[model samples]
Target: MVTRDRCRGALLGLAVGDAMGAPTEGMTPEAIHAAHGRVEGFLHTQASGTDDTEYAVLCAQGLLAHGRRLTSNDVAAVWTRAVLSQDGGFHGAGFSEMGAIANLRAGVAPPVSGNDNHESWSDGAAMRVAPIGVLCAGDPVEAARLAREDAQVSHAADGIYGAQAIAAAVARALVTDDHTEVIAAGLAAVPEDTWTARLLRQALDVASHAAGMAEAERELYRRIPLFHYPWPDSAPEAVALAFGLFAAAEGAFVPSVVSAVNIGRDSDTIAAMAGAMAGALHGETAIPRAWRTKVRQVSGVCVTATAGTDLVDLADALYEASQGNEEYENAT
Candidate 1:
């Protein structure tokens, strides 16, 4: 039951959220409030998505090219052609991706490329995994499996787990209106003993009791123990924060994405992930017309080849690919 609207919403919502959150990224919640005074909408007149949206487009292309048979090698091959061969440096790409690219340049393969990287626990994988969910709608297990295939190329452990969680959640959201159930599906995709799982549970617990987004932010900031690093791209923390905000907002598209943006700290990726879940739950109609229109075509600030790519067309192609996979699976 993966309708066209839901498919459009997932990709468009992710791009819009990434754009909306870009201005406030890396700032603290207090800093965001001090600067923007509660970001209710887009900060710039002509907003554009950053690396988050570009990487997502890359992922959608990968899925379309390989379908359900997508492997880590397939992902690496795509990256080699699309990412590594690009003329300039990967401008706004995340640390994990840069690490993987460096490894790939040295002829190292994935799982090893990801493992040898220093930022393997970053949220880079989760930021671009929503398409796997769109294709595997109502089948969280398949979504998680495919997400791992994509993630293992540049992430490991909690990073891969975070991608799996978001993919599984988006898949469940495509079929159910209950946000709690959607979150449960995501949790089920990963091991309970993992840091991602533990942080996710704690995030939800804090969000459940909070009065509003501000309170939830405070509680999450206090409760979650972040690594003593300069960057705030921890996969476990970002996924936990995104899902917690999604739960708090009860899966409302605008509110969930906006809250994640305002909460700051890797805001673009956090909002993008939340927006993907909410969009899957509610469909394209839930996204505001203005926001969706702004992100229809990516700016390709990170992945140059994805410039001018229309998310709507990609979404439709993904939906059709999903149908083809279903037909093939049935025939087999």
Candidate 2:
């Protein structure tokens, strides 16, 4: 079972990583270096998370509302009620989610809502699955199932598989300290022949064999072919890179998140995913106090109505819900 500290760490680490990486999201590694010269700490004066943390909170809300019985209809309904109906439009939200919302407004239902007819292989699904991993705890298979179902409202194919892989890794992390087991569980979440599976396997191999952090990062990024992809939002590539960072860090929270951030493109989301996995494995106590203190409730610049929502309390509520505790029965 996931301890309270781990649960808190999972969400807190996500927010911290997101906030830390937000300032460099779309920049290339060279651009990042030229601008900030290696992001060892927060770059923005008013740092906060973007769509990643907010969407994860939304996922937690949906899970709390329906428990293990959560479905595509449930996700779609929540999205329609909370997201599509919100003011300000879905700014900062990725193309996949934005496309899904457009479909929802057109009276489309899910998984059709998710099948937006565009390239549905973005990191959008993977970005929001840590809550499912928290709820499923030690059961990687259950985590993968719920992640796939949740993802069905916004992703498909490799996109869904990417979310599954992250969720499975988090689930394993919650119960054990062994990163190899975590990596294996991640691989087991999807079929072997999938693009996501291939990338994940390659990343794991690279992380295991590489001499050090720099070598692992270089080899893993090379395998992902980040420059070849028009956008670095490719789900397989993002998830694999996040996993490789976690492996290279050997489950240390800061190192994993920092590597993900400094590696560049789609930096925030990749770091967020890797942070969640490491945080789950190491527990909240393992996270640096300075970074934890720096993280705050979001202002909804991206996810409008979710502004000021307390991430720590929300995480606790999810953890409570996972254990069948009813303190938050009336909460989000």
Candidate 3:
């Protein structure tokens, strides 16, 4: 199922693990193992992708200019005409997109400007909800209700339930290849009395009873208390440390995106949401052709309409608009 080389390897493995964890975002996994002892590859040499691959290629070009009747004011007017009426602003964006661009430049519109006077919950809507998991690829609850209507606009309530649990685990990893049934369909699309679903169900039950990946990162840091937040970019700590490193790399794909770029704070949006769930559970020939020939295309340093955006030809036009929205919902 779900091919197109795993939808162009889940958007080129989320822009090659967001340009290999953009310079170790705010290092401190022991200062990224004393400054790069284990990044493994592609730390630089023109590595790019920032605002989490330009807000997931402007939400897959607004789900192909409005499909399945996309709204939330058409994703807040596609973030006010491709990033707040660009002019070399909004680069490397954060702080819930600078508090929804100061409440959409004070005109404040969109789920009330994503909670105006924002109290950020970070992970900036799970790093652009992976194009609503390629526009609801296999419909994990309509990709968690279009990722909570494009994450309220910027994020709120456990950061819009951590972008609806990584858009329902990349829409069940684009249709079953069973990584624990795609993390149990992204924890059954949220609401197990959240704190982002109890730290993603206690970090996928201690990464499903760890045995590897350094004993599942030391039994998920001795059962998650995460050193009282010294930055993991809280969308419930970067979506429970990207679903506990994709259940401690049981999903493989380069050991769950090189353990999300050596597990540093917000390391390129947790290695672009664990490289879009292990490139939608191992596709695009498991991404490694010299890092897909330096995964180029993005130039707008962080959302200037994603300057040249070509994330594997916009994920093959969002997998051909999710096969015309699953044949217009099976012809209504």
What local distance difference test score does each model get? 0.89, 0.85, 0.77
- lDDT, residue 203, candidate 3: 82
Q: What TM-score fits each model? A: 0.96, 0.96, 0.33
What's the lDDT for candidate 2? 0.85
Model 2: how far residue 329 lies from native, Å: 1.8
- Best candidate (score: lDDT): 1
Ranking by TM-score: 2, 1, 3
Clashing residue pairs for model 3 = none
Q: Which residue pairs in candidate 2 collide?
A: none
Please give the ranking of all candidate structures by lDDT, highest first, separated by commas.
1, 2, 3
Cα lDDT tens digits for candidate 3, 52-114: 878877777777787657877788887888677777567667777878877987888777777
The TM-score, computed over Cα atoms with residue i paired to residue i, of candidate 3 is 0.33
Q: What's the number of clashes in each of the models?
A: 0, 0, 0
For candidate 3, what's the RMSD?
17.9
